[model samples]
Target chain A: MSRYVLRRVVESAVTLILATIVVFAGIRALPGDPARTLAGEESDPATLAAIRATYGLDEPLPVQYLRYVQKAATGDLGRSPRTGLPVAESIGHALPVTLQLAVFAIAIAVLMGIGTGVVAAVRRRRPAEWGANAIALLGLSVPNFWFGQMAILALAIAYPLLPASGFVSVFEDPVESFRHLLMPATVLGTGLAAIIMRQTRSAMLDALTADYVRTARAKGLSSAQVVLGHALRNSLIVVITVVGLQLGALISGAVVTEQLFVLPGFGKLTIDAVFTRDYPMIQGVVLVTATAYIVINLVVDLLYSVIDPRIRVGGPAL
Target chain B: MSLLEVQDLTVRFRTEEGPVLAVDEASFSVATREVVALVGESGCGKSVTALALTDLLPRNASVAGAIQLNGVRPSPRARGRDIAYIFQEPMTSLNPVLTVGRQIGEVLKRHQGASSRARIIELLELVGIPLPGRRIGEYPHQLSGGMRQRVMIAMAVACRPKLLVADEPTTALDVTVQAGILDVLRNLRDEIGTALLLITHDLGVVADIADRVVVMYAGRVIEQAGVHRLFAHPTHPYTRGLLDAVPTPGRPVLKEIPGRVPVMRATSDACTFADRCWRVTEQCRSVRPVLEPGPAGHPARCWHPLGGKE
Candidate 1:
């Protein structure tokens, strides 16, 4: 297990390096120059030169990549071109908000999805299965952005129940922060829940038909025990994989949701940086998202051993 | 009195194409301290009949007629405590995610309510799994195929069921391992005195372990007699064909049963085996022959018995 973990960590590091190179190349290849975007038309050439030099934008591509790698290795993500603030510091401030939203959304999605999945699988051929399936379809079909806008319109503008936009720090007042987060989380989480629920239901249905389940029943176990004991444990592996893949999407979803709710999360920060051409902030956010994706997959892969011992990470046993 | 008496039991599956008759009105019994082998080829409803005994048939299947266990008609919903089924594929029969001990312990907890750790270990050791203390923590995938089948047997016998139905238990195993598994089952029968219902297509396996044998063809029992009588002087043409098919060492080239078992399209009013029988006649094709005594308490389902001595 330790060897497996070590191997995964090394693979993740390589993935992160590849991702950094790709993101850097793509951003640098964009049409508009960062120097031009930073300095307006009224600025003198010398001032532009100075600005470019200060940001190290005038360096060769190879040299610029080296500096970028160096800074990332040391946890210094350079300074934002728009705000002229340290990119790491800006992201640090925004990350907590995004993390809070993502965690809450995922928690709700997993709980509700797995619960409804178990119910649907157990009550197969019943009205509950149809109802759960319908809900899942609705969740999958409705876009998160549209859902967010509709939720804001319905709950904030018309009903006047929730605050329409803006975020409150949880440290200031936990209850107020929760209230601010509730609607966005619901909108973002609904789609994830639907996906997970559908997968879980399907996996559970397949597991229930397995020979072991029949053996469990032949042992005189009750219907509930047969489903939960034999079916659910095996079915959870697929659900876990789906949930892990969704973590990346959840972070991405938080960006649009944060914008709608006016929450200062990584999503909102990245969007702001994109509009102003803040290369440092944009790179920093992308790096963090990439890291999150790699790490979540690594964790999910490690969990496979615990869920089903037959899956060995280091290839077939020697 | 027989420990298990299944009389005129019929099982059918409702498929999208049509209603397929899986197990045609089959009747047989297992007496206490006796081993009865239900022998047949694949798709002859041998496994389905065993499954029906424990109400383990699939959802679309409809089972009718009487299945009395210890004088009580056991329903599909309430059969586990009295009748337990060991399926063909031992590799898949045990839960992959669960430990062998827990899988066996589940039967105890469910039927006998034996929840103590010590009791589970005791049951594990009883099935010949080594180092029950350390091995109890290992999952089904950790064990070998033979060990897994032992775990399956342990689970089936956990409740001390009156009748144990083994559906081709050794079919998935190698020849050498097959004998060991059969020995384990035979020993269990001798030790616990539980009536054993062994279902298989292998005549050689039945010859070695079974006291009585019921030969089936086209989802119907064609012959049943003591093992000695069936082997020494077989009656039904299907039984004779099955015996002829088994290859014997140092014997001249074996006789093969020409053509496959006929598929039952509609409920047969005539002999189901008439299509494949070399001695088939107009009467054989026109009238279905029910089981009747041949010799030495042997019952053969045929108009004309094979082996003229009978």
Candidate 2:
């Protein structure tokens, strides 16, 4: 087990490093000059060159990359062009908002998806199963951004029940924060919930018909005990993998949802940085998100052994 | 009264083609403290009959006829408490995630509340599993095929069910392991006065453990008699064919039953085994023989049963 954990940690580090290089080089490839964007339209050539030298943009690509890596490794992500504050500090503030929203979205997805899946599997071919299937189909069909826009129009503008275009910190005011987060989180979670629902239903159907489930039935266990205790636990292995995948997607690609809701999240920050050529901020956000994704997957992998003893730590498995 | 009485129990599965009859008017009974072995080749409805006894067939399957346990028809809930079923593959029958002790305890707890841990340990030891203290804590995969089968036996007999239906219980084990499983089953029957419905295609096992044997061919009971009587004075052609197929040490070649068990599209009045019977006559082709007493006073469903005087 220790060996597996150590191997995973080293592999995660290598992955993060490779992701850092890609983000760094990829952001630099954008069709805009950071120095020119930093300077005003009327700025003289000397000021532009000085600004370029100040940010090390005048150096060779490798040299500039090394400087940025060294600064980033030390928790210095240079300065935000618009705010004139440390990029790390700016991102740190936005990070929590995105994390909060992602957590909410994931919670919704896991609960609704697993619940729907279990219902569908248990009452198979019944009206309840059909209803769940229909709901899952609808959720998957509608794109999340489109769903968010429609929700804002109907619930915010038309009904005026929600504030459609801003965010509030939960610490400052919990109810308002939840109110502000509800629409966007639903938009992001519905699509994920649909995917998870499908996976869970299929996994559960397989598990429910498994030989052990029959044995449980033969043991005089109630239907509830057999389904929940025997079938659900076995089905969770597949659903957990989907959960990890959806979480990574939620954290990394929540740009459209954040933009629609006008939430000050890392997704919005990283995207705005791209338009304004804020290379350091973009690299910082990508690195953090990638690290989070890698770590989440590692945790999921470790959880496999805990859930199933057949999959032992550093031992043979069927 | 017999511990279990199944009368005209027929099972049909609805398929894309149509409804197919899997078991046809199968009647069998197990008396108290008796082991009645249902012997047949694969796909001869042995497992289906056993599963039908508990109403455990899938949604596509429709079962007819009466199943009475302890002289009373049992509800779905009472079925499990009164009659227990063990499956063919021990490895797959056990929940891999749960420990052996928990799986057995679960059955005990559900049927009888709050199963004592010591009782669980006792059940394990009763099945001949050594080190019941440590072995109960282990999962199914950690145990050998023979040990897993023992655990399965332990779970089946947890409630001391009146009738235990074990379907091909030792088919997946080695010969040595097979003997051990049979010994455990025989001991359970002798000790608890539990009636057993043993399902296996292995006649050797039936001869070793079964007091009476029921032979099935193509979804119908062809012959049933005392184990010794059936082996010594077999009547039905199918039963004789089955007995002949068993390999003997001195025999250079084991006789094989010709053709396969027919897949019945429609349950006809004509004999189903006519296509594969060596003693089949025109009467056998045109009419389905009813199960009746022969010269040896054993029931066989053949028009011209072989004489019992062999």
Whole-model lDDT values for every prediction: 0.85, 0.88
List where candidate 1 sits over 4 angstroms from the true fold.
A158-161, A168-174, A313-318, B75-80, B307-310
State the lDDT of candidate 1 residue by residue for A1-318, as single tens digits. 788778889999999999999989989888787787788867789988998999998989889999999989999999887887898999899999988888889888988899999999988889999999999999999998899889888999899888877777778888888888889888989999999999999999999899888888888888888887789998999999999988878887888898888888899888888888888888999998899899999989999878877775333331
Give candidate 1's root-mean-square deviation (CA, Å): 2.4
Q: Which predicted model would earn the best DockQ?
A: 2
True contacts kept of each: 0.75, 0.67
Evaluate model 2: give its TM-score: 0.95
- Residue B60 alpha-carbon offset, candidate 1, angstroms: 0.6
Error of 2 at B296 (Å): 1.8
Weakest lDDT window of 10 consecutive positions for candidate 1 chain A: A309-318
**lDDT (tens digit, per residue) of candidate 2 on A1-318:** 677778888998899888888988888887877777889777889999998887777889888888887888899988876678889998899999998898889888888999999999989989999999999999999988789989999999999998997889889999999999988888899888988899989999999899999999988898899998999998888998999887867765478899889899988888887777777777777778888988998899888877887775443454
| TM-score of chain A considered alone, across all candidate predictions | 0.93, 0.92
Q: Give lDDT tens digits, candidate 2, residues B1-310.
A: 7888889988999999887889999998899989999998888899999988888888899999999988788777765578998888998899888889999999888888878879989999999999999998888889999999999989999998898999999999999999999999999988987889999999999999999999997788889999999999888888888989999889889899889998776678788888888877899888889999987789999988888544
lDDT (0-100) at residue A108 of candidate 1? Answer: 86
